[model samples]
Target: MSKASDLKRITELRRELKRHDELYYRDAQPEIEDREYDRLKAELAELEAVHPELSLIDSPTVRVGDDRVEGFASYQHHLPMQSLDNTYSQDEFFAFVARVEKGLEVDGARFTVEPKIDGVAVSLTYENGAFVRAVTRGNGIEGDDVTENARLIKAIPKRLKGDSIPEIIEIRGEIYMRNEEFERVNALRSEAGLELFKNPRNLAAGTIKMLDRVEVGKRQLDIVLYGLGYCQPSVVSSQSEYHRRLGDWGLPVVEAFWEATGPEEAWQAIEKLDTLRNGFEYPTDGAVIKLDSFDQQDVLGATSKAPRWAIAFKFAAEQAETKLNAITIQVGRTGVLTPVAELEPVQLAGTTVSRATLHNREEMARKDVRAGDFVVIEKAGEIIPAVVRVLTEKRPADSEAFVFPETCPSCGTEVTQLEGEVAVRCVNIECPDQVRGRLEHFASRQCMDIEGLGVAVVEQLVSRGSVSNISDIYRLDYEQVVSLDKFAEKSARNLLAAIEASKRVELWRLLHGLGIPQVGAAAAKDLAKAFGGVRELGEASLEKLVELDGIGEKTASGIVAYFQDERNRAIIDALFEAGMNPKAPERPKEGEAVLAGKTFVITGTLPTMKRDEAKALIESKGGKVSGSVSKKTDFLVAGEAAGSKLTKAESLGVKVIDEATLLEMSQ
Candidate 1:
């Protein structure tokens, strides 16, 4: 067929697919059978392939397949995202109410109480009544742009319902994956033999940040707008009115909001929300209580970090008592010793609980937790299982005080507790426990990302003495690796290749992999960027290091202390001599022309670029890509069937560009 004819057919097919996408994703109704829809999508894809010039940016076929970006670029918020003050008890709630009333110079106060969603907080920007940007709340001031991912949420409108579109509007809300969807995702992971996420929140957070927008779309993530950031042509004067207006604008707001006249009424509302929380599709950790009147809110103002007119009344943590069978100490990758409570197996929060983290010596002392005591345990944020308190009344009469170990449990070496630090750590770097922890941390996603290097492999290597230090991993022969149980030749080769490839990882990863105290991923990046290289970082003085952004005295001291240890210094030397890249990637100069006036949504796997890299490329070019797709998506650079985003893009008539097109545009 001629190119013109093919283009015409592709356009017709795209229009048909877009209509179906709107029917399925936006309306939650499917008019066509799955097979029939697939055929249409396949035909369109074929036509586009034959007439490459005809492929537009809003194709339905772009949702599921390939294109991947390297990483997200930083997006500064128009308005700073502030956290709300938390009120844990009735007294605290009352105090908050009193404070708000006093600030407003009123004898009484009214509050709007709504369920505090247990999900990732995000900001959505709309321009000319069309969806523009969706960003994660990163450090309050800056956030990761996730517009494509956000567009996948059917609840978030791509276009305003009425013609009365505000020139610019910012809506703040929670993006959550429902419990049922979380279960489905977990099931898929389990089927794929992958580690299951601890909870919906973690899964949602990880999924949204995925380089593949299609993967995020498949998770059935949803959003509910709870607050307004900046609204031009303000539609409402009070918090209650804002909710009503948001709902009227076809945005998903909280299901119910209660107007409490005073503290007593507020507490009552809180109790009501807690009672009703179990019935909701998503999880809520608490209730948000905010002054109802906008004028009152203005009068109350805000603190540097939180608003004085609003407070979150966190519910009491769920707790269940179980017998503490024993106390054990586990050394972390950094050699920090942590105490674990071995409990009699009991079920809590939909999982079997046998171990709970005691955090450190300070926490143990604070709670006065003891072995042989009936301890109340709860999952912190319904994720990490933790011992909350001890039931003194139910303590065994023969029980003795649980003593914190003074020595490394694995190597039997003396443990040292640093001044002003809560954790007591083993000084022996070669301790068996330390080796296992280090290996695990090294293979972690944020580190070397060595696929298939799980706890079992690390344990086998440690137990057999196949590997001792981090450097030993590079020296592993194929035969030695394959000798372990469940290790096939192919698996062994893959493992070796992964380790070999890991040597090329950036310096920030190497810094984090070192397990330095107080140096997390963010800090590692800062250190790497500040020092330029690991060797320089190792030799830098604490004062000089502390001068860097986000580097505090404690972290600087920790870095200095780590390097001062001859053993750690030797390990660094060995790794450096082993030919691992120890330098940070050079920062790219911000581009001026590329991605200008164009927005792209990356979904599924791409042949090139990690998600962050793709995001950076877009931002460097002066264009913005968001986590979710909305009416703002000028282009959805779909790799695979980019899931809900593909559907949404089709529904909104946004262009769905591909990786090749994206690359060409970037040039």
Candidate 2:
């Protein structure tokens, strides 16, 4: 290729990659798969390496997070939260270590290795003993202030614990959502007629930057402190000590880290960390190794983009070759249609990889996935099995693009993707699969606590036409139940007794069991306490629903829409007729709420009461139970073998109370 053409191609690649980076970092929307983006980036890097004279100063390789999202009050960082250099192979990682050694003029330098968490990076500021502010790592030199959102993370302390806190500190951390929590959030979004977030990292970035703290609080987020950005009084000496102090100060710190003395040791640690990534609840894509000593880091210094002392060893995404045998559409309870890939069973990431989510038709189109085509599948975070890309070389000559069915496979109803939504829906309330799902959820332990009601029973009852809706479970005749496939005379009687016991549940349980879209257990409890019963919630105006704390406009509209459904209203009538009438939340007796104006940290095991029992007692009397001890904690409820919370409470000079004292105060 000519030098002019090579230069032109490099310029075009930079332009395209810069746009992709903006979509990813600033807008929280990615147009292409991660692997494709990596390919383009690799191509550009290779071209620039060969033609060093043509390398532009403002190339994508030299910049970090250039997209400054608007609407955030930006603050200039005291110390830049720089990006890390990524290496996809072990050889490259070793090469990075060699460079570090050469730059420092040292031999067998110690390194700290930990999982490279794939999430939003933020800078936290602590003043004295209090959490002062937090900001997103925007454009490296400046960031968006997100102090309100950061406070909602329970893993982070509002106030420092123990006596080791410095006068001030700037901590760097990654705020992330667990894979399971991300799935749950997507479920709620689907129910609320909102678009599902493509991945966890994007959701983390969006959630942290939201203006409304109440909405942020609804979705629980967690964070783990990793490094120190700026510290006053020069308190910490090493990376390992920083972690120890983080835990001592009642902050969430990553525990999966190892110390290594050389490249071979670091290589072994990286392999072990890769294997352990699957077990972590949060997503991790690679391993990051940094020089262990702060003094050493100072000596090595950094470049304009990333620190020279640290390098991120990205695990070449673990993928398996599989054939897409068939595509099946799953009908969720809210009637959203999701496609699942039925693959020829293959091993991936230590497990049999037979199925993966296609998300929706839009995702299927973007990936160009089709039935009978050979494809590459990867576990996103070693948890969510996703089809990363297609292997077109192995495709059969007769292979055809998959046609997503336009009709409901279960009920034969004509389906359509609602306006502005990608999910195709049956829209048929009488669909048998939907009925079975609703019944299953209504009787689950978290809802009605109905024992002896399992999936088999629900399926059998639904198939036999005994249960048509949630209320039909209460109307089940004991004599007819014994006639089912698995029910014995004793078991049938016990099932009937259990059904009778479920009638006296609180309003919150009934609210949750109704299978209302966008309504979760916590939301049900809040609605129950605010409006008292289903009748009140159903009849309340939109203004009243919105007036409640934490109930957003979308949630308010969903509550109104659910009550407006004729079929749902009929089921509620059936519930009332079957003697399952629910009442308002129970009110505590006047003046008995002695635990007000105090925060108590409970640890270890109590002899007299279970943790839940003790927590209920405290909350019923207006006291708050905290997960960790802090200087603001009024008392620490000490029990047998109380651990770090106890030590922190003692060091902070907070009062220590026994179970007896706790019980006495509640009384």
Best model per TM-score: 1
Model 1 RMSD, rounded to 1 decimal: 19.0
TM value for model 2:
0.54
- Which residue ranges in model 1 land beyond 4 Å of their true spot? 1-70, 105-108, 183-196, 214-218, 347-351, 361-369, 378-380, 403-407, 416-422, 476-501, 541-561, 564-570, 573-579, 582-667
Give per-residue CA lDDT, model 1, range 1-667, as digits (tens): 8777776677668656655643332222334433356568678767778765445433443232111212766565666678775667798788878877787778768889999997778899999889999987764555678888788888888887865568998899998888888889778655433346667876777677777786666778888888988889876789988888888789988877898898888889999998888788878878999899887778777764578888887777667889999989888877788889999999876568899988888889888888899988876355557887899999878878778888888999999987756779888878998899888888876577776676778888899999898888887888998887777878788888988888988888889888888776656766765666888888999889866544557678989999999888888778867778754756435665566556566665456755556767776675555544655568887864355667677877888877788778878
> What are the lDDT scores of the predictions, listed in order?
0.75, 0.79
Candidate 2 clash figure, as a count: 0
The estimated TM-scores of all candidates read: 0.70, 0.54
Misplaced by over 4 Å in model 2 are 31-39, 49-62, 326-375, 379-667
The TM-score obtained by model 1 is 0.70
How does candidate 1 score on lDDT?
A: 0.75
Q: List, residue by residue over 1-667, the lDDT tens digit for candidate 2.
A: 9888888789778767766776677666666655567788789879999997555322452256543443467665667789887777888888988998998888898999998898889988988989999988876756788887888998888899897677889999899998778889988755432346667887888888776678788897989888898888888889988878888898888859899999999999999997788888777888889998999899988865689999888787678988999999988777778899999999886567899888898999888898998888886444457787898888889888888888988898999876756788988988888888788778865478676676777778899999888888888897878987756898789888989989888788899888887676656877886777888889988998876544557678989999999888999988989998676665567897788657787766678875556767887886666544655578889887675567667777889999999988887
Q: Lowest-scoring 10 consecutive residues by lDDT in candidate 2?
A: 54-63
